[model samples]
Target: MTGQPLDAGTIAELPKVLLHDHLDGGVRPSTLLELSDAQGLVLPADDAEGLASWFVTSAAAGSLEAYLATFDRTLAVMQSADALRRIAREAVEDLAADGVVYAEQRYAPELHVSGGLEPQQVVDAVTEGVEEGVAAAAGAGRRIRVAQVLTAMRTGGNAADVARLALENRLRGVLGFDLAGAEAGHPPSRHAAAFRTLRYASFPVTVHAGEAAGAGSVAEALHIAGAIRIGHGVHVIDDVVLGEPTEDDPWGVEKARFGDIAHWVRDQQVPLEVCPTSNVHTGATPSIAQHPVTPLLRLGFAVTVNTDNRLMSGTSLTQELAALVEHAGWTRDDLRDVTLTAAWNGFIHHDERAELVEDVIIPGFTERSNGRHRA
Candidate 1:
């Protein structure tokens, strides 16, 4: 293959790394129907396709609040350990099928404890499911690695407890901690205690900021909460200012300016876990063509594409890449760049990160390019 923009099929075959996926949000629609039926719960649609369409449409309701309300039905079906395990396992299988070599999926264990299981039990069940899924996929000739990121809802009071849970299970596939859910009024500072605890324990933390809010939310996530990666940080573009084109550079190439927050994020090499389809669904952008990904990538920000909620976005990592290829005009090299960035920023050990790049990513891309590897 030449150094050209990759088509959808070729893009699907390339190795990928995902850092911002959600376990609850990526549940299979068929699995949701099965779980709902087993629990005698009434769903908006009785069939899988209809249910999937419903989730996608409802999430496009133009506001983050409306977008998040769709999770109520999803969360309702996740009360049992068996349900959670199945969801986790199937998530791995789906991602592996899409050629994901590494993933760190997140979910709130506290949310799954409503049926009387302890938080630790929830973690163990999901971890077991991940391990089982990886083995099953490996049996079928697909190699993948998966880790868990325990999440604490920003509106809830169990963040510190969840942080401790993450530490307890660090050796058992738990990778890091995250603060998810509504981000407007429930700022990261609200969970300062949890951040302080995780910081003291030397645990890595990612915060959901600048999605439902503005750049200040990102600042609090960094300064107040000490987040290393930001989930859906599209709003950080609010801090970036672009000047009018001049005669010397008609596109204003050198006139783009970054505010203090954006400057810090870029200079510090902080990763922004950007989910293009999910961002459009949440009204962060009207469409993929209008997303700031192109400019952000050109501006040299550490941007890594992701599938934040596959079910909600009705997407796969491949679909996300394809959309960028078509709409944002991203090339094979651009996809490779972001995949490498994600692998580096992944919440794994340094040796594992190096191995992923040196072994899986580079080799896969090289094979796809017919041994004409990029320098």
Candidate 2:
């Protein structure tokens, strides 16, 4: 599940699903260059490759705080409704081209208000963008569907407002609510009211925990915040028991009889959005070879791989899969399995999602694995 250089044609034709990518974090570097230029905002870099490297260096190779700071630049130019809509549309278009059949893109709307666009306008722009992008994809025979996950920055004081915005758009393309930001100081408990409000509305929710923080933060996300999905739950390994290697089981260890909060998450089938490259860049894990995702996958956890920030991480879902396959020793079957699991576990309608699994995602991958989908 770590590093694979799969055939480019295979990757392009294979159906994929993404659940944890950030709307602001996945912007096209060229789009960033053009938008920032019009806004008279000088970037840390000028060209696409430089801008792309700048994002990865800032996000993957930087500290958690520094990784987050990269968003400020993207959000700064996305204040206007037009800008937000354009970026969202293009985000979907780009994902579709990468062979993504479904993606649930999340963003903290609190950061995009310099132009005084109302919170509703932010949701509207994103939903409109999805519609347009889906149409464009259909025209190209890619066929992609997207849902927006509205995130409230736990460090920001607008959790309640963001929660409201997510609720308002639930009837539209908004599928869930989430709290994202610095996981250390800003725990999910800090936004108890926002979680409570969302709960009252009977809305589904996911939380970005266990990345910057460990077991304690994950506990609060599930127990207090009702997070059905975990964003970057790589730190779940912290609670696991790993003993010395032995003969019978080369990896001699026990699933701690005393299950930690993270174990409960896996045992209970809560999906972890495992972004391998982003995890490495942020020092969430020491190396892709040692990523907790491989172990988690073996343990039968609902582990779904993703590119948490394509632009910032300098990766695509295909690259993420390739990395996992080549480095992590994942086979073609393993790739299809993860894609299917992600398709099932993503925040979409049960009926629509069922169709996605049986029709688009499963069929495409299944046919490919069997050589039937190959052209």
Candidate 3:
């Protein structure tokens, strides 16, 4: 294959890694509609397309504030244990069909107890759903492994409660911890005690910073919370500056200056979970074409592409990667590099992560681009 943008079909068939998907946010339109109706929940739109369009428009209101409000509908329906189970199982099925070989999906359990369930109940339901989903994928001739990342709403209370819940279930498919929800006023340092607890437990953490706020939030997430990865570290690009160059360096390749926080993220190879469509919806970036995915990749940053919310942003990992190739001018080999980076940064056992990078990921990309070869 030449160094051109791959079509949607080709992108859909390649093995993919997704690190930032939200479990409740990725529900299918039809499923959401049906679930709402079953629970006697009224919606603004009657048909599935109309409801989906409503969500996309609402989430695209040019501010992270409005974008996050779109979750109110989805979260309301996830109150019951059964509802959580069904959505999670279906999410994994959808991921497998979309060529997601491995995924780390996150959701806040605190959002699910309004219907009279305990915190641990929500975790168990989600864990069971993940197991069923993996089995469903295998029965369909695809093997997919999924890990749950429990999210603690920054605007809500008692993050240490959520952190303890995630640690309790870590032996049961719960892999990591996150601080999601509104990022404006709720700095990660607000939950310093929870981070300290998780750190003592040696659990991997990914904080949602630098998307709604600036580099300061990212710094707190790293230093205070001990974040191994970031959810949408887009604003770190603000610290970068490189005016045009002259002479033999006509490529405009001056040093891309970074702040102390940015320097640590880059030098430590802390992965950034970038969602192109979601970023555009929240006005985090201008256009999908202008997303920093490829620039960070070429600059030696461990950048991995993701779909923050398939329902809200209306995208998959394959679609995100395809957009990068089409609009960002990335090559097929570049896609492979990003996939490997995601697998490495994934919150999983070291042996399992290594197996994915060595066995499944590299071989699938090799087969897709160059076809079968001699031994």
Which one is best on lDDT?
Answer: 1
List, residue by residue over 1-375, the lDDT tens digit for candidate 1: 545888888888899999999998999999999889988999999999999999999998888888888888889988878888888999999999999999999999989888988999999889889988999889878989999999999999999899999999999999899999888679877788889988998889999998889888988999999999998788888998867867654434477988999998889988999999998888888999878877778788899999989999899999999999998778989999999999999999999999999999988898888944222
For each candidate, what is the lDDT? Answer: 0.89, 0.83, 0.86
Local distance difference test, candidate 3: 0.86
Deviation from native of the Cα of residue 108 in model 1, angstroms = 0.5
The candidates, ranked best first by TM-score, are 1, 3, 2
Which whole-number lDDT from 0 to 100 does residue 26 have in model 3? 91
Q: Give the Cα-based TM-score of candidate 1 against the true structure.
A: 0.96
Give the TM-scores of the predictions, in the order they appear: 0.96, 0.94, 0.95
* Candidate 2 lowest-lDDT run of ten: 249-258
Most TM-score-accurate candidate: 1
Better of 1 and 2 by TM-score: 1
Residue 192 Cα positional deviation in candidate 2, in Å, after optimal superposition = 0.9
